[model samples]
Target chain A: MTGDGAPRTLFGKVWDAHTVDTRDDGAALLYIDRHLVHEVTSPQAFEGLRQSGRRVRRPGLTTATMDHNVPTGDRSLPMADDTSAAQMRALERNCAEFGIELHGMGSASQGIVHVIGPELGLTLPGSTIVCGDSHTATHGAFGALAMGIGTSEVEHVLATQALWLERPEEMLVRMDGSLGSSRAITPKDAILSVIREIGPAGARGAAIEYAGSAISEMSMEGRMTVCNMSIEAGARAGMVAPDEKTFAHVRDRPRTPRNIDALVESWRETLFTDAGAERDREHAIDVSRIAPQVSWGTDPGMTCDITEAIPTPAEFSRGDESRRAAAERALEYIGLEAGTPMEDVRPDRVFVGSCTNARLGDLREAAAAVRGRRVADGVRAMVVPGSQEVKRLAEAEGLDRDFVGAGFEWRESGCSMCLGMNEDVLGPGERCASTSNRNFEGRQGARGRTHLMSPVMAAAAAIAGHLVDVRGWELAEAV
Target chain B: MRGVATKYERDNIDTDVIIPGTYLKVHDHAELARHAMEGIDPDFHSRMEGRSILVAGRNFGCGSSREHAPIALAGCGVRAVLAPSFARIFYRNCVDGAYLLPVEVGQEAYESISDGDELEVDMAARRVRNLTRGEEHEIAPVPEIISGIIEAGGLFRYRVPE
Candidate 1:
């Protein structure tokens, strides 16, 4: 089905299929297959549409939810923050006026836009998905060409279901070796390590296809975690070539296509990169070498292995004085000194949630680590499920009980403490071991320090009261 | 266009720093403007007053698709941001939303442009004139599609020819 008879990468195939038209400048009008809307980004976009008096082009294709600004605690009470309440109400009203399906705050399907898209089967392989949130790339784990758009593009998509964009260059990020051998290296660690290697802008303007043995061996949830942080490396998007694991994850979900079997067969035939296709850049990472990564500074790239010491400004700064200055500033803000061991830095809190790691698998891993253990004294910890559905499933399996039994707060679902748009925020100067993505300055709260890690690592940090490595952690009886 | 520059000579000035996540729920342009660069510089709103050009290091606006970032900067009267490079989504949002200009300059220009340097950005000539320092620098030529969209005033006004 490759039109030009040239071997095409999966990105090329998906992008080409969705091309509505192309201009001379190589800018293509891409038909969007899915549009995921969240409260924080959609308000202005909806307002723009309302101002223009335009109805949604394809209401059925658009799905809305209240996530970013929705409070994760006590759904029964009225939202205390008026601005957040207004925004949530705006989303509800806008969805109603536009006739778009909204998974409201209390709806079973309501959760992080990225999490619910996959859980409900709205995200399909070989599709083009766009959301106003940067982490929309999380859906690329399904092998879709997913990218984040801005509010303006949100309105544009609302009106036309298409937007003009120059084709992104392709990059092949191949992960070789065996993740199975690296027992403590979760997909979160693998991605953090990739970001460390590439720096923040490493994959700028490129859509990355994650290939090689390790990526193939990962579960769908793991793939989602890896793809979720592609934006952190400044990549336009990140994806994996859909395999049987992808199909199995999508099968019989609430929103999957009716002809699932035939679709799977077709996907099996054409969803992968063709032989001999070229990419603008290629980098191979050995998964076995990746340890549990923890971001030590403001940006995700400012990371180190669990066993490594904090990097000095001179060591990490590649001759750029500005980079060194930034590193110095980050250290000052993070309240850490160079050469300090990661394990020695104590955490004030532990958060196991966000679109990146609040899935059922992630919770199961975290719960296992915390099983029969209590959260260290003075270290507040919480586990928020990725979605209500994930919460339901976790509770059904007694995962919630394990977390509660371990003294971790089992809260409701949303993007809780990820960006801290909701009530689950870190106090100023509080350091947290978090399973979410992005350790940017004030990402969780003003002056809040976030150390990005895997769910198990966060759980262990809760138990140990410090940023301890999760490997070989011994779980004794709860005190 | 001409204005004085307010430079933050550092890389990776992220959106969360531009407009902190706490204020994301408020869509008012003016409200967002008040908190522009709140995370990194609490005095940014005051410091940015009367300045239309913002110069910074590499990878400016490096996190989030909040668009609130460009919206906040633009709301604070920033007409153009000159940096070595910009994050992909932030760059597009700046251009596509017609919020502000994201001008990519070489490292020399990015460094040489000083804070409070009165400057003129000539898009047609593809040059930046440092009026205060009396130096001229070439900026990356805006791509054809981008120029076309800008001329037409953002994506909504510019119709892509089929």
Candidate 2:
């Protein structure tokens, strides 16, 4: 489509390709390739249709799965929790009633809606995917313009098979240079460090496309980790241009075209920003200097490198009054003092699972951290794989043994700790170093305090009985 | 409806807290509303029966773009949510669902209104009247474009123009 005869960037091309109607209000109605639905948000939308006595506009375009409410342990039907059981049943009923295909509980393909979409070869490059889950951005790892929507919006999509969204201003986040040697740093660390530097509002109203040598070299799982948390940094969605890595990840999948070579050639054309193409903003991070990051507060923005001390409320107060209040509240809730070395901030729990960091690599890294060391006494630790396939592959390599042997609870796959949906919850006033996306108050459970971190760091905190630098564990050497 | 605002003096009150992630499975509005704010206060369902306007600090509904949040709140009979700011997704969800009205009143307005003040929200006038204090604070109104959607009961009804 371009002069160079290669796809510039999946986003660049897809943005142009899916233009159904651009409104004067700046929003465009873009055609969606796949609509992934889950139990948590689809019911009302279906009800809305039923009330109107209308059939699904396009049943073939949508797929349903049960993830948010299903417990991570025991794949048996009729969930142990009555409320969860009802919700799962409701999903089964809704899917069957609407004639929508569903990967119900215990299905081999069943997992987090976001994880299964890609693994099942449903998320194709250059396609527009919408799910009710925020981490739907995970599909962008394959060069799709994947974004999350609300129930009403989900209903709108179901009715029209399209979404009206204001075109996000473009931004390029280039992570150039070689990675740091601390071995504790990872793509998760890189993204967290970037969010810390840019602040939460930095990427507001932008569609951020990650680029540069570092991003290109990352595996598909690593890219998913980066894009999954884009919303945390206030981006509409984060995307990586599809490349060889993207093609390799989806090449043999069910939906990928059999003419792989030609498909790659066509997809390559969508792989980069046009020369001198206009962008609203551009920022670069020299990955070499970043260290493993940990959140010491209620918001993702309130984070610092592991080596740094907790920030005093007074420090933030001088800058922005709102930030100051947030810092003070974070201190009050987290029960931590400003200027306290983060290493000294011990956690009662360590959770290494979420759409953000629960991929195979994250498990491998966490397993490496806990391979030989036992979980410290008085610390509760868990390892929930992101997907069933990820769980299978981890067990195939005995990664599960390393985790279980270290005293961490190795549970079945789903969005277990990422959201406190099932029994996987933290008790009141309990402090946790979580690998999940959010650190909001009571996110893990009622009165449970969450501190977001990388999986390796979560493992380190579980072992050290505190939020310590994961590099101190010498995980790389263990491998 | 009259009651003192037992203000949740915090910012970024995410949906997970408003409706715990566990309650999301239940499709029954009545059932889901029963657990609304159970994560924050166990008696929230009982406390928020016919009266109460949640007064939050800033950016309420700040995580996980879940629509059940507003639905759960409305089902529990919450009249309005007054905060300094709201996350984009939650804001849009509330508007589209036409359940709870989100008013973006400045901090000064929040400071002036005492915790025990009985107030009435005049949606049409874009103002909050503190009946206890004999004072009224003019709040920025929802944009006409969005108000129309709410007036029609919800997005579904709004889409079918008269």
Candidate 3:
């Protein structure tokens, strides 16, 4: 239904529908359907609006939350950090002045912006969503054209509910083959493997359409975990074609449209890319070959299978001196030798949460891993759910008890320790097996080493006291 | 515009390295300035004493959408960053925010330009002159809308057509 009878991609269809104006150079004014705001990036934006005498154009479409700096511990306690307290107060004042609804720190709805958007159903299929935080791409799991914008664009959206943008070229990442019968292989692993195959900036300037059997078979939460890390692969946005699973996930959410079935029927017609639509580039990966991946170096691309040893600088030096130097630096910073077996790298801490793997399914995976096992001595571990709702759901399922009984800290929801903005952070020189995206130097804390992995892998590392392959956990425990 | 370059001949120099997350709470330009490039170079402010341009490898500002990266750099008096390529969001952020110019250079220019080289960039001519080395290089032409944004001094100052 591209009107001209030519095949169109999902991205093309969404772009055409939301374009308010187009220029000769292909730049178009895009109508933003949803704006998810968090404290870290919105202060300057709201300050800009106040200075310009501009009110939020459509406050109803905008939602604010305190996530980036909110401490996950004891909400009732006065925030000991005065600077963080001021930032939170600024957001509350701005939201009040702008008349935008805020899911403040104590609100049950308060959580990571990306997590609550989908949970509340603000992120709908075929909608264009933007947030200042990079993980805004997480909403693309529902087939929304979601992207992360900067504070300037955030102000633009607040002032006009639109953004001027040049459409990104489309890339197709066809994920063929099964992830196998074992539940150990997760969406986190699948995406880490994809980032390894494609370098960190592999999908630069393009939007990726994840397709094929593996994506189709993934549960909505799993698909979200995959889409959330799309930004880490250097794609501004990544999405899967919405289908029954997407609709079913939305069917019972709080913000579904009044005419759900009718909306879905229309979504079915236009939300999918036509069979012969052209892709600017195509890449394929067999999901069956994907194992639980662990990042050894500074970036996500420096990942390998849990069973593989840390690679040497010479391995990266083949025609790329920059990569080789980066490798050498990463190895030195991460405190690992090239030939060290991944299993030999014992973590000082284990973090089983982040926007990437903090959903209900992810919690269930981690709980299953540590149901009866105790955390290793001298290793500190914690699980921060993606949202308050996820925490409530996990507690209802006794997952909290399992984590606490196994000596893991079960905390409230926020982006805790993921970016280390709050009190939860790794001490200097402490190495952690983290489920968060980005293994960049000091991502968790200043001079902290991060090894990115799946929830199960992180949980196993907590019990085993090292980065052990989750696939071989049962055998190792039996022996 | 003419300025000396501070070169980092590497790829994927992310925003976290440009401005660490710990300083994200400090929105004041002066406070943020003290921490510019704190992750990669603890002495970045001192290093910025005479330099106003940054020359780097590919994918500069490749992580987080924190406008603080460019803001911190601008606060520290960095007017432009020249790289072989850039991450999309970062490029747009620079132009839209008018914090700094993110110029895309070719392999030849990237290799020829050295740290501490005196250079003059002419946006209108789409050319760069390495005065210290007596060499010149062509830069990718700024897109039509981007040039307009630059002329207007940021997106807020520019008017979109109805």
Supply candidate 1's per-residue lDDT for A155. 93
TM-score for the first chain of model 1?
Answer: 0.98
Candidate 3 Cα outliers beyond 4 Å, as residue runs: A475-479
- Residue A387 of candidate 1: its Cα lDDT? 93
Please give, for residues A361-457, the per-residue lDDT of candidate 3 as tens digits: 8888888889889999999999999899999999998899989999999999999899999998888999999999989988888999999999989
What CAPRI class is candidate 3?
Answer: medium
Model 1 bad stretches (over 4 Å): A181-183, A475-479
| Model 3: per-residue Cα lDDT over B8-77, one tens digit each | 8888999888888889999889889899888888898888889999988888899899998889999888
> Is 2 or 3 the stronger prediction by TM-score?
3
For all candidates in order, the CA lDDT equals 0.90, 0.79, 0.90
Taking the tens digit of each residue's C-alpha lDDT, what string does model 2 give over B1-162? 344454677666777778877667667789878878775577877776546677776667767878878888888777678777676677778878777777778777776776556778777777888788888777775655466667887666664233
Model 3, position A430: C-alpha lDDT score: 96
Candidate 1 per-residue C-alpha lDDT over A178-218 given as tens digits, one digit per residue, 9 for 90 to 100: 77743467888888888999999999878999998889889
lDDT of 2 by residue, A161-245 (tens): 9876667778888898766545588888888888877766567546889988779777788889888888887677788888777
Tally clashes: model 3: 0
In terms of lDDT, the best-performing candidate is 1
- Candidate 2 scores an iRMS of 2.3
Q: Residue A263 of model 3: what lDDT?
A: 87
lDDT of 1 at A204: 85
